[model samples]
Target: MAAKATEKTNKRDFLNHLETYLSKRDGVDKLLKISRYATKIIIASSLIPETTGSLIPRLKSFESSVGVSRKAFRLGKFVQDINALRASRWESNHELVLLLIAYGGEGFYYFVEQFIWLTKSGLIDAKHSKLLQRISAWAELIGYVGSVSLKIRDLRKLKDEENCVASTIEISVSRGMAYEEEDEKMKKIKEKKTLKGLSIFQDLADGLMTIADIRDGKGMLSAPNVISSAGLFSAIVSTHKNWISC
Candidate 1:
């Protein structure tokens, strides 16, 4: 009877983790799509003439492509709006892209942070630990994407420096150097933050892995057995109900 109960608990924990994993994946996908659209809008507004007309149509197209509701779309717009407010004094392409990149980076960071919290809180179980691992992988991938996009922007700035050499060469050169320095600083900061986030994720992954390894090897481990049992499910359901009520 005890053995049968342990098996039942293990199965329940696995299913619970699976559900959480799927939900997190869906959330990540939605955010990634939103980020891509935001990037497009930032680039379009910066490069295209007649900002409002060009921006609105392209934004609409992106909206259609992403299939996000107006309310959800407004969230992306809110990030842009905040950036626009900040860059109101200096209207330029660089400002737009920087704001977009910062906003997107922060947004991704927050998402990962939330996932880390969820995992640490035991809201996520061993089976879902695998999903958390994947989430960490995705976070790294997103960081690389942001880095590449910033690099392209840097290259474009270099091209601009070459174009107007005679009149504003010295100033352009100085400005380019400043931009490069700033970019490097920002890149280092972002890398540091990403590493920190990855560290937290790795710690959580390690804990989950340890749990899994113990469960697989030991036929009966206290933590896994407790988490796998009906008691754990009951606690989860109760906590969820409380959350909904609150």
Candidate 2:
């Protein structure tokens, strides 16, 4: 019991350190650049040409107009807004809430694009489409929850640091992380294991690769898009990893 409590305390300390480190002037500046570059890579790779008839604006409009309840549409719109905000430059505290939003939004959209295709594929192969949908549904949910909750937490922390009144939304993000699915949960375990703060940086490479695979599998990538995105992300992810190693 004591050991587990000590572990919890250590994780909290790590979070505090992470928040402090990222809040530095340089930290925020560098991350903003990183997010901008990442968004560009994703767009150039996946969206513009692939969905020629229905790119971002069109897809977003269609998604909003889908047969759904008012509440569902509102929720979907909120999710979509996060994606739009991700590309727009913004400041964030040490928690990197904005970066998390960009990430979650990116992941969500990637899966969404695939799901849209899967919807189209239903007429051709319902069985395969159903399987893909099942797999992506959980991933989409994770991306959504992780993205929004982290952003909310970051805002709350900012409020506290800036000399504000007490907050009411007491959703402990760390605790919530404990209950995430195993594959995602395992990443959290890895986070606690090293506590070096380098692994989070490594996630850039992993995420970009995941994006590439999904785009390719969905037959959404043109030859130019594939070559450009793969080369760009590989170079960037490699440079960062090398710097971290040194």
Candidate 3:
């Protein structure tokens, strides 16, 4: 009876958490991102037998629809970077520069993406679509580059901090003093490092997709399967990160 009750409690807690996660804008966006990339992967992969003539086209249509919806969700999202840039002005010079490049690039991408979305929706000239998409891809590439560089620097600092904390933990343990606090601090640092590493990987994956776009999918890296796989990996990593935070 006790075990059954505990299981029920855990299930209820999970459902509540899931509800909370789905309630946020970012949460919904991440889910849609996952859906969009997963659809792409299916369309690129051979897992589905082509005997079903209409399946691939339907999947492509779904992916495209999800893509447009994701853009709509991101409408006005560039304001976040504006605020981030504002807050970053007082940071270290290196950080400030990277933040400027990263946020500026992302902001411009999102700003231009609005028009691209409009063009796709027939609200703007269809002739402008290709140019706008190219510009957006380039901006996204720049933003990811800056973001990855900044994260690498941050990871290095975290590594140093982790080493310092580990040394303190060793000394405390040898002296037979309480080391619980140091141990906890080390755990937190490790968690942060892990998250940062995941973020870097996600950024790199997204950057690869952007490169594929900028190159018109001509190179080896731009292969449909490779691009879809990278996009799906990025979506899963981001979704995991967002889910945990929720």
Candidate 4:
């Protein structure tokens, strides 16, 4: 089980950590290794008799046991409960990945082995309704997209810098000073609050010429900013539609 959150930290701690993690060399290496191992597993499973069906269908019950049961666990009561679940820590992505693969991986493989056994012994009844399965997948896809927007908002909280949202508006008004072009107001107007490199799916290119236009004093908001923003937005929508199509 994962641990519960006793204290909620600022959203910056989470989003920044994910950004840093995905950017690191060691973190990428681990994900690559995990991918390689997964690929090998799938390839090996292909050698299994076709009558056994897809390995994924066999893993459904395993997901219920190993993935969903963390709801019952409390923080600190179990060494690893729901709270133990975290995205990569910004400082130690490699170490964090190792810990999850160590603790979480054990439960994952154990249940998968159990699934194989039950299938072999004819003790398992595969009873997932096709419509229910489709709905579940659809709901999960919706939740996944919502989570992307949620994290984007979490990153937006990062612009607050002082954790001032829960407190008074005075915190923001008090520390204000600069009126320079580099000020927060300018950044917000440019819509580049957080790091521009947050996601690879978005880039300053494509309509990157607009950035030059702003520099040349053409207009603050021009065709390229609108075009690039619309492109990125549509990328997300297209991805969702393509996923559902498959």
lDDT of 2: 0.46
TM-score of each: 0.26, 0.26, 0.92, 0.24
lDDT leader: 3
Where in model 4 is the C-alpha error above 4 Å?
1-124, 127-129, 162-246
- Compose the digit string of candidate 4's lDDT tens values, residues 1-246: 123343444224656665676574334333433343333344334554446576654543443443223222211222332244453343366544544543353333333434443543446554533333334333333333433443454466555642343233344346674334335444453344333223323322222322433244246444433443433443343333332222
lDDT of each: 0.45, 0.46, 0.90, 0.39
**Candidate 4: Cα lDDT at 55:** 60
Superposition TM-score, candidate 1 onto the true structure = 0.26
**Error in Å for residue 185 of model 2:** 39
Q: Quote the lDDT for 185 in model 4.
A: 46
Across 60-86, the per-residue lDDT of candidate 1 in tens digits comes to 566554433322322333354346446
Query: In TM-score terms, which candidate is top?
Result: 3
Ranking by TM-score: 3, 2, 1, 4
- Model 2 steric clash total: 0
* Model 1 misplacement above 4 A: 1-106, 121-123, 162-246
Q: Give the candidate order by descending lDDT.
A: 3, 2, 1, 4
